[model samples]
Target: MDSSLIQRGRDRGYLHADEVMAAFPHAEDDIASLDEFYLTLEEQGIEIRDEEESDEHPVPETPPSLLGRRLGSHAHRADPDDSLSSVS
Candidate 1:
């Protein structure tokens, strides 16, 4: 297990399960080793995400209603005569 790989994972805040498995192939079939690997990752501040959770669609931190409120607030700053401003 290279420290650089762990550092990169920490910097990105996450690594897919496959990435971890690929980096530490010996841990694959050993349940104890796998658990220790996960703990080490957690200690290093790296989140382990399943490959199914692709980066293409990141989870939104803000809820939709809160997002709407933020956009609405910005809309109020737009010119009253702006055509888009008339939209509800």
Candidate 2:
């Protein structure tokens, strides 16, 4: 795995140290947040990578809630072939 990915994983809340330590049984208690690890890597002259493939694709934040409770409701409507079909 790339150091940048490890740093990014740590920076984001995705990687839980205590959970990992508990699961692995051999993991150490000494742990640092992603941001902290990033600093250490930077001091070592490690290059930061942009994981995103392109700048055009924006990262989603709002989530799919705005789409309503059911995602395929419209598609499952009576007139499935017609885009104008409405699902109750």
Lowest summed-lDDT stretch of 10 residues in model 1? 72-81
Which pairs of residues collide in model 2?
A: 10-34, 11-34
The TM-score measured for candidate 2 stands at 0.22
Measured by lDDT, the strongest candidate is: 1
**Error at 31, model 2, angstroms:** 12
After aligning candidate 1 to the native by TM-score, how far in Å is the CA of 61 from where it should be?
3.8
- Whole-model Cα lDDT of every candidate shown, in order: 0.76, 0.47
For each candidate in turn, the TM-score is 0.52, 0.22
- What would you estimate as the lDDT of candidate 1? 0.76
User: How big is the positional error of residue 1 in model 2, measured in Å on the Cα after superposition?
Assistant: 13
Model 2, total clashes: 2
Per-residue lDDT tens digits for candidate 1, residues 3-80, read 776787878888887887787687746778678767888897888888776466766598877877878756656565
